[model samples]
Target: MKRHARITLLLFFGLWIGSPEGWAQTTESGFVPLLNGSSLEGWEGDPTYWRIENGTLVGEVTPTTLLKTNTFLIWQQQQPADFELKGIFRITKDGNSGINYRSERVPEVPYALKGYQADIDGQNKYTGQNYEERGRTTLAYRGQQTRIQPFTQGNVRELVKNNAWTMLTVEKSLGEAEALQSRIKTEDWNEFHLIVKGNRLQHFINGVLMSDVTDLDTVNGKKAGLLGVQVHVGPPMKVEYRNLRLKTL
Candidate 1:
């Protein structure tokens, strides 16, 4: 090839290799941002509660604006299946919210989601837990390695002995809840990480592995769905999120 032609090809691949979007789509841990930091582009939610303030995605509720149900601000760009998500969160003393992945939106309720949620709260008791928004609820608490076993009777799904759809067999493999809680920063921003690969999911906060789950429930396993942020309905609360990034595997 000619010298100029080789130079042009080199520049083209160099740009592609360094591009964030291109890298995120093809490389592990190459993050592509979900929040633009200045505006609410590529997201949908109830403007009454969700907004961007000071370059952060803020969800606030007042006593007068109490919500009847949990609401979500959903991402419109992608419905990720196997991926890693990262963000920074800050919450008030009363705040309760989470990042829901592989979740389906509720048709009856606006800005509602029902699926896997990496739970977050200011109390540190709930943060880093694996929760299903409207499904099995608490699949795994903080500091646990849980195994979900689901049994079926012929074509019908059989409930577990407790009448629950799946039997939760938990192994306290992770560190103590208090130890994981120590990594959390209340009323201040903390790093959050979530990984979902096939029927396995993991949650981490401030570099601590909070929970891990091996989902054996074939009847209710989520392969791919919407991604959303939650704002629970309760006392006056506020939660701020920033640096939303994702890397698909």
Candidate 2:
């Protein structure tokens, strides 16, 4: 009877230790992959401007471009109210590329016509700033020609590098007030992190906290929709994006 009791106790302990919660704690961290790296199987974009080349997502621009057939690589997965997005990008030359969040497709207008863009322009004197799509210009700098306001000068300066991989992160929140922010580091491979919830937003670059802007009036009343990558049409230009990833909050 004593031996049986001991065996029963041991069995119960073993089962408890091997329960799902114990196993899940380590495997269920927040990090989730947005891009599968094999193909654009889950994403939709204009074939004319977006493609996966050598495992890096490439967005190309050409002269004499028209609004018709303009391409944007969109995340097929829809997000809820709160989440974070991070990615790495490299711009080959002077052009424009931006990350669009909470965006919807308007057949007659540009993809960003209703979303917020963590704006990118290698040629612009002020790069890596937040701009409200089809809304008020939130930030602007570098003379009237290039403008950035909400994001700090240090944040933009740190995130962007000349012809090198730079980390980019954008965070948004829907709490008491709406907000949006971003950061970047120059000339080195860095990490970009963003947090979005309610109407508040935060941005980080290579683990450095950059901006914390609030009171954002995002499209669609702060709900989540599609995340997109943009390649502005202009003189021939190319941008490479890889290790694209995201996680929900």
Candidate 3:
């Protein structure tokens, strides 16, 4: 009888030790949907400029309602430290938009984001790059694996920007920026992938590596902030995003 009791206790302990805490373990590592197909309950933005239509998050800039500055639709739920974000996006001609992570909400600008942005343009020109909004524009360009070094000049914190802000050199070039041009579907949906961990950031489009940036600037860099979607300031255009998913690690 004592032996049987011992066996039962052992079995109980084994089950307890082997069991998972919650459904997070038993299920596959599924990505959480940030944008619900029906409503924009957890998001904040300008109603006239942003809305949900046919299950997609849509942003539009019309001729009469031209924007003076770039604006964003921010996710109010959470601010992820290390994560992977992905979605399907398609923009019209001259339309430009971005996925901004670790970004600060500018109350003065009202829906403007000020931090690292994953840039994409309608002309397929600036797609797949790390851009610092209002801090340092164009931290890394397409097909670039870059590292930023402090500029030695007194009180000058960042590396110099020659006329344009594309001075950061590429450490490893997986492919050229032009290589991704043909790969991006102009009028159709294109997949965007962004991964951020520690001080490293990488951007990909349509399964191709676009740019990588290693941010060592601690004082100016952001460790945690909100995620946002951009509708750039320019001519009238429309952009749509769907199937937005995020996974934190």
User: CA lDDT, every prediction?
Assistant: 0.83, 0.54, 0.80
The list of candidate 2 runs beyond 4 A from truth reads 1-28, 63-71, 110-113, 124-126, 139-190, 216-221
lDDT: which candidate is best? 1
Which scores greater on lDDT, model 1 or model 3?
1
Better of 2 and 3 by TM-score: 3
User: TM-score of the candidate numbered 3?
Assistant: 0.83
Which residue ranges in model 3 land beyond 4 Å of their true spot? 1-28, 150-169
Across 110-194, the per-residue lDDT of candidate 1 in tens digits comes to 8899999999888877999888877777788888899987745443224322323356798667987777789898887788889
- For all predictions, the C-alpha RMSD in Å is 7.2, 12.7, 9.9
- Summing lDDT over every window of 10 consecutive residues in candidate 3, give the lowest-scoring window: 19-28
RMSD of 1: 7.2
User: Model 3, range 1-249, lDDT digits (tens) per residue?
Assistant: 699998887675532222121111111255788888688889988987999986779999999989999988999999988999988788997998999999998878889989899988898888887888777788887878898654333433354364224435568876756776778888677888899999899998888888888877676678889999989989999998887888897
> Against the correct fold, how does model 2 do in TM-score?
0.63
lDDT score at residue 49, model 1, on the 0-100 scale: 91
Evaluate model 2: give its lDDT.
0.54
Q: What is the Cα-based lDDT of residue 102 in candidate 1?
A: 94
lDDT of 3: 0.80
